[model samples]
Target: MREFLVEITTTVPEGTGQEEVDRRRSAEAARAAELAATGNLARLWRPVGELRSIGVWRATDEEELHEKVLGTLPLRPWMTLTVTPLESHPNDPGRLDASR
Candidate 1:
C-alpha cells in the first residue's frame, strides 16, 4: 500500500445555513470514523496555527485514495485539499521492507 499525507481546510461559506453545516459535520465525523476503522485513515491531527486537518492514509494508489476516499468526504465541497504521496526512506528504521 502507498501512504499519503492529506491536508484539508474547510470553510463554511457565507449564507450557508447553520443546520446544513451541522449535518455535514456530523456526517464527516461518522465517515472519518469509518475510514479509520477500515485502516484507510491511519492517523489524523490538527496542526497548530492552521485551520486545517492532516491525515495519514494508506491506499492501493493515488487514484484509489482520491476516488474512493477523498471523493466521499462530506466536506469535500467546502474544503481545499492538498495531498502528498509518501515515499519511505531506505534508511528509516520503521521503513517497510518487502522481504519482511
Candidate 2:
C-alpha cells in the first residue's frame, strides 16, 4: 500500500458561522470513516490553520486513492481538493520503515 495525501483546499464563504463549520467538519469525519472501511484511508486530519485544509493519508494505488477521494468527500459541490502522492524524502528514506 502506497501512501497518498489528499489535501482539501478551498475558500470559506464570507460570514460563515462556527456552527456551519462544525457541521461540515462532522460530515467530513463521517465520510472519512466510510473511506476507512473501503481499505483506502490509512488516516485523515484537518489542519488547524487559516487555509482550513482537510488532509487524508491513504494506502492504495493512485487510481484507487483518487476514486475514493472523489467518491467519498463533499469536495465536489463546495470545496476543491488536491491529491498528491506522499513519497519518502531522499534525506528521510527510512521514514516508512518505522511503520513496519
Candidate 3:
C-alpha cells in the first residue's frame, strides 16, 4: 500500500441547518472509523483552532484513495482536500525502529 498525507478543510454552506450538520458529522465519523478498520485511514489530527484535519491514509493508488476512500465520506461535498503522496525515507525513525 502507498501512503498519503491528506489535509481536509470543511466549509459548511450558508443556510445549512445545525441538525443536518450534526447528522453529517456523525456519519462522517462512522465512515472514518470504517476506513480506519479497513486500513485505509492510519492517523488523524486537527490543528489547533482550525476546522481542518490532517491525516495519514493508505491506498493501493491515488485513484483509490480519492474515489473509494475519501469519496465515501458523508461530508465530502463540504470539504476541500489537499493530498500529498508519501514516500519512505531511508533515515525515517519508523524505518529505523522496524529495522532494529
Candidate 4:
C-alpha cells in the first residue's frame, strides 16, 4: 500500500445555514471513522489557525485514493483537497523493512 498526505480545506458558501454546516461536519466525522476502521484512513489532524484538516491515507494508488476515498467524503462539494503521495524514508521508525 502507498501512503498519501491529503489536505482538505472546507468553506461554508455564502448564505449557507449553520445547521447545514453542522450536519455535514457530523457526517464527515462518522465517515472518517469508518474509513479508519477499514485501514483506508491512517491518521487525521486539524491544523491550528486554519479551516482545514490533514489526513494520512493508505491506498493502492492515486486513482484508488481518489475514486474510493476522497470522492466519498461527505464534505467533498465544500472542500478543496490536495493529495501528495509519500515514500517511506529509510530511517522511518515505523517501517518494518527499512533496509529495502
Instruction: Tell me the tens digit of each residue's lDDT in model 2 across 1-100.
Output: 7777776665667888988877877887788688778766766566766565555566557786656565656544567767788776756855757553
RMSD of each: 1.9, 4.4, 1.9, 1.1
The numbered model that scores best in lDDT is 3
Question: What digit string (tens of lDDT, one per residue) describes model 3 on residues 5-91?
Answer: 999999999999999999999999999999999999999999999889999999999999999999999999999999999988877
Reference-based TM-score, model 4? 0.92
Clashing pairs in 2: none
Estimate candidate 3's alpha-carbon lDDT, on a 0 to 1 scale: 0.96
What is the lDDT ranking, best to worst?
3, 1, 4, 2
TM-score of each: 0.89, 0.56, 0.94, 0.92
- Please give the lDDT score at residue 31 for candidate 3: 97
lDDT of 2: 0.67
* Best-performing candidate as measured by TM-score: 3
Q: Is candidate 1 or candidate 4 better by lDDT?
A: 1
Could you tell me the TM-score of candidate 2? 0.56
lDDT of 2 at 26: 86
Better of 1 and 3 by lDDT: 3
lDDT string, candidate 4, 14-65, tens digits: 9989999899989988988999998999998998887789989989999999
